[model samples]
Target: MDADMYAEAIEYELLTQAIYKDILAREGVNTVNVQHNVSIVGRSGVEHQVDVYWEFKQAGITHRVLIECKNYASNLTLEKARNFFAVVHDIGNCVGIIVTKTGYQSGAAAFCKHYGLALKLLRKPTERDWEGRIREIHIKMTPRVPVSNETHPIVCCLCLRPASEDQEVRLKNSSEQNPNLVHASPSMRFLGKDGQPITEELRLWIPRQLNVLEREDGGPYKKSLELTDHYISANLGNGIELVQVIGVLIEYYVETLPSNEVVLNATETVSAILKDFESGEWEHVHSAK
Candidate 1:
């Protein structure tokens, strides 16, 4: 039996892991584990799962990497090459790479031609390359960011609401780079619209809420409160009655300020800003997820 078919695919995957290990060393990272998997959003707004994801951290900045290895006997075909596209949005944010012994399908090659990254080709490892090859590539999880419990003026980075509630014991820090994700439904569309997504450039996980969405078009603000009336009137879909909005997430942002600080910072918080909507000194209610 020729060893290049099934046997070679396995061997190629092994070599890919070896290269990943050396990459960590080159990047000043210490951990390595193989067969890493990652699911991240692509430019197409669809989530893409990757074969190998490399991760590391230094001086508090975190890094995520995606690795693609091709072990085909012939030049890559369109379908196989299409695999190389794998729905990546920004390689700038990732340590993007491809490892192929036989190289990519023309389609895949053309896709990755730009973005300033070249696929790294791996030949048979020699004794010299063996020392450089890392036995494995495992990523380290980043530490949870530290937040304080003391209630201060906090703002919703996504919806831009100053009124936010602290879910855990501590109030999360806010930053501009942070984006929030919420499953789309009718009620959520209204909320996101009121949140001024275009101005904030907020990320919307909108998946057809099947409800009327109102937006303030500069010429008109949604004075009718049609959405509010709809949710309140229909009271539809399992415990979805509209409670009178006491306040919005903006207030919480205001309160989370360091007493002396007047202006609230607009940095988006990474964890999530949804849970903080409409928090007044209300008693906690347990809702089953």
Candidate 2:
């Protein structure tokens, strides 16, 4: 429950609302509002700010879901649950939920049972959740030569080589050049439609939550050590492979653990679609599977 953990909790709460937006729509809840820092007037005429608030109307009835995010090192205690229950009761017409990083204590669970409150353990998402989005697509070679087989292993759109192999070489070469560089490498270039080489400065940083390629101590070439330690600690247990390039971390793959809520971190204001194929469609690379 340090600063970083608090920030992560806030982000997770927002993410939860987004992930359920579509489902709420399907349930005929058209006026769903999911937001943070919501102020509500309780029955005692006092206002309180909630971490997350989800509300929708159905059949002239208002339904509200209030979520409290707790990123504590230890289990949530019964006292906290009682305070939350009080807020929910005062608010009225609301389902109360406590999302904790670790879990709830036995006493907290008992309190929740008695009060009909829901508890959810939260963690970062894993690779297993990205399966359905995985698609098999053919890769193209240099000069945009499409591979005939659709099920072929996807190639790096830049080097016209297996993406994994290309990434390995890039990482190896960077580490060799400056062992501290870990995943940071020079930007890749590809041939544009005009037959000229186009430098791909747009790159995605994977394992979204990790501070890889950077040292916790703010020294030189320190990313690998931190990332290695995280892997050993089971922080990055998702079997996710990430590539670092000389650009930006554009795409994000995120999941809230225990809840198994998955989200792609791309906004309508900022998104990139690869459409180099003849059909002019985005190709799905099944490498993540």
Candidate 3:
């Protein structure tokens, strides 16, 4: 076969294997082994090439299934179906299935139906297949920002003095470039009472402290508010310990962002759509083989 034909054949065989494997899994047949591009010896001592093969044992009886894949541009004909039936007959005691990219001729469909052979059409989904289906999703996200205009002095209970201008007490390992901004993360660590290292997640203390501060100030107002009840301490470097947070100057505002749209196209993600010729049942499948 040429390069294009070889590539298409490989893709078609793999697609068939993936679809059947998924179907068997959904049916709770976990013991089955599904494989692609296998060769099975027939009773006549002739080895037949099987595009996709699967077998399982049930009640001490081993059952096999053989699949033939065709990636031709044109529809399958009656002659092709008959040729495949010969292969299935030579390799007896196995179910036969034929999958093609395009639909089959009326005569070929009738021939497969008469011989108990399964005929399936597997191909990329077209625009018509997406009728009444979800094609896209829209998500709206609004961000609330806390803007701090000024931060007053933090008092140290041990020394009974305010922290120096050079001292900085913020979220540890914060990625924000601005030292005045403090971001919240569960992974952030801080020093608690007696200079013991602890996470901000301990007893949900950090969030509770912020909630108390917000409640006492009645939202971010242009005034110096002192937190007297909460005495959560943090050790700034250079032997400076902040035991009391006072005169917090912050403002909260909401910023509305544009809606994010995501398009869901089956043709983009799904490799093929399998349709049973007899029952007219169909499904979209992603290739993993």
Candidate 4:
């Protein structure tokens, strides 16, 4: 066979395999073994090449099914249908199906129907098939991200001093008799004066305070608010005793990210479209890749 012809034939066999596998799964035939490009010996001792084959045992009896795939640009004819019927008849006690890309002639359809052989069409979708169907979809995504413009200096209430840019204030949990030093952040689980975790309370209070500052300043501005009431003690590590935390600086604004449009096309994503010749029912098989 020509290289193009061989490639097309292999593609058709793979498409048939994908369609039948999904069909078998939907029909609840999990125990069946499906094979591609296999040969089975007929009752007359002649080995026949099968494009797709599956076998399963039901009630101790083995049932077999065979499929032939044709990658022809033209419609399948009566001769091809008769040849497939003969193969199925000689094989005996097995179901036969013919899958083609362009569909079958009227005579071929009649012949297959008379012999109880199945005929199907599987191919890439065309413009006509996409009528009233969504060919492509666009989705707009916008993200709101918090942007910090300025962070004010932390103030120690005992000595009435503010920390420098390179300085970090260590916060101590006052609920314990010997309070443990802990790093201060929005996610810290430090205890308040009431001996309850004030992390959640601080998260809510900080935003409210920032909003108040934004409203008062009418724009970007620096503001400080006490995080918790007498529960948090801070040390500047400058020989001063751990003093109560008066306030911490927080200033930020929310920036909306640029909107992005994502486009998804059905034709590019769909692997194949399987259509039954007789029933006219169809299904879109998406690529697993």
Candidate 5:
């Protein structure tokens, strides 16, 4: 897998953990978060890092689950699961699991075939409609209002004082202008409430992962290209109404995605995400090398 795929793998694990925490645990099912790279002292006086160790209560029985995630690998064995479980078994009443990049070993399958005195095997499911996921992502990334120094200046919009240059500003066509457009102007500087000049870059860059998601799902609405693209892409395949979907995106992206780029890539990134939304194909744009 490439960098993009690697990122996806990392995100997948995190999502799985969230599912265990949010859905399973919230629904009253037994679940827990496993810490990665734990250290434990063995009978031999040697210490090793434990991949994941957590406790969950099932059937009024507290069970510690030690899990290892193998995002890039394909094969795992019953023997491996046995060792992991054994190591933790001496520590407490526990279960061991090894999540691999691919499918399992027949031996491991047989071992986990029984509960209490058994091992466990879990198979990752193939994706059905990725378009939906892409859309949800877009919604999360949707652009908010166009910011401005007057409406949303480097300094507080309420106060037109010098702000740190690091702040970003979203802007749209204004029928009237605010005489008090906030800025980092030296004259606006103050000692207490008035902040130092907004000396930072005004815009934040979008990450490649979100960029990929937008590329896939952005489109169809002819509204503000940026806002609509985010809405469409984010809502695709989710069965959510377009109005509600796009509204969320606008709120999110407006809150995030640089109003401009620090270097020169800002223009290109904005243009590209919008263009992809318009065209519904990220294929045309050249990815960052």
Candidate 6:
């Protein structure tokens, strides 16, 4: 593979490891190795490397699991599946898994099924598992223009106050050059009623959540029911206007707060905000996947 493909493959492997680790950890399996290299002695005395390995002891017996990540642009073919199955057969005493970024072809899937191997398509988790996990309060605000002469005038920020009554969490513009727009993943999209395209200069902001832990030194946890505000500034326009929200797509699940309220973690938030700045009624799709 080339440099880009190599890096992509590494990322896919890491993602797979994270996902499987999360799943296995919940199931009480504690041993999982990412990017693990294993040397298996072949019948001819030759050795081969296995990419990812996992093991757990159950009832005094150690059960081993092997995973191979393939980040290909197209579907995995039957030939590669056969090769992987051959490796598994040679290694012996393990559960084999093939994780593909795209998907597996029918022939390849059949090969894996015939050999008792698993095929998983690696993708972001859908929201079904996290729907009622957190408490949320939504508020809509427009960008305000200050009379003072500044490089960027209109300031629009989203302040979320969860039902927990925690401190207000603020999302402000993260870009110094733009001063009113924060970077967004999956990019925001808006459509007009005509089924055509409508464009508006918008800024992105990701909310932040805070956690409190008790100090081992005998200090209090200093717990707060409300969350602090992270700043995110956006310039929608010169005056107060309505932004009609249509839909929202979030990449990560909301986490439970100290007060038992659910909210988005600091590192990530809604990936795409679908709106027209007209009506506030928006559809929050928890599991469109």
Give the per-residue lDDT of model 4 (tens digit) for 1-289: 9999999899889878877887888889776778899988889999999999998777888777989999999999999999888889888888999999898999999989888999888987777778888989999987554444445322111212223433333322232333333324454333455555555644454555444422422234455555444344344444433233555655455555688999998888886788888886775464646
Model 3: how far residue 227 lies from native, Å: 27
Worst 10-residue lDDT window, candidate 4: 153-162
Pairs of residues at least 3 apart in sequence or in different chains that clash in candidate 4: none
Best first by lDDT, ranked: 4, 3, 2, 6, 1, 5
Write candidate 2's Cα lDDT for 1-289 as tens digits: 5898778777766655554454466678666676776999998998977888888677999878898877676888999999999999999998998866556788988889788887765453234323454323334322211122234311221111213665566545654676534322334332343434444432322223234323232212211112211110101223434332222221112222222333444222122221211232332211111
The TM-score obtained by model 5 is: 0.34
Runs in model 4 lying further than 4 Å from the true structure: 25-31, 145-255
TM-score on alpha carbons, each prediction? 0.34, 0.42, 0.60, 0.61, 0.34, 0.44
Best by TM-score: 4
* Cα lDDT tens digits for candidate 3, 1-289: 9998899799778877878888988889877889998999988999999999988777888778999899988989999999999999998888999999778999999999999999888887667756676656555543332232334222111111244534432323221344332322333344444555553542243333333333333243333335432233444444445443432332332222444555554455665678876675665465432
lDDT of 2: 0.51
Question: Could you tell which candidate, 5 or 6, scores higher by lDDT?
Answer: 6
RMSD of 2: 23.3
Per-residue lDDT over 180-243 for candidate 1, one digit per residue giving the tens place of the 0 to 100 score: 3211222342333233322111113221211212321111111111123111111222232222
lDDT (tens digit, per residue) of candidate 6 on 75-97: 89999899888877787777898
Q: After superposition, how far is residue 128 of candidate 1 from its true place, in Å?
A: 17
For candidate 1, what is the TM-score?
Answer: 0.34
Question: Which regions of candidate 6 deviate over 4 angstroms?
Answer: 31-35, 124-289
**Distance (Å) between predicted and true CA of 98, model 6?**
0.3
Looking at model 6, residue 158 earns an lDDT score of 28
Pairs in steric clash, model 3: none
Instruction: Give the Å shift of residue 272 in candidate 1.
Output: 45
- Predicted structure with the largest lDDT when compared to the true one: 4
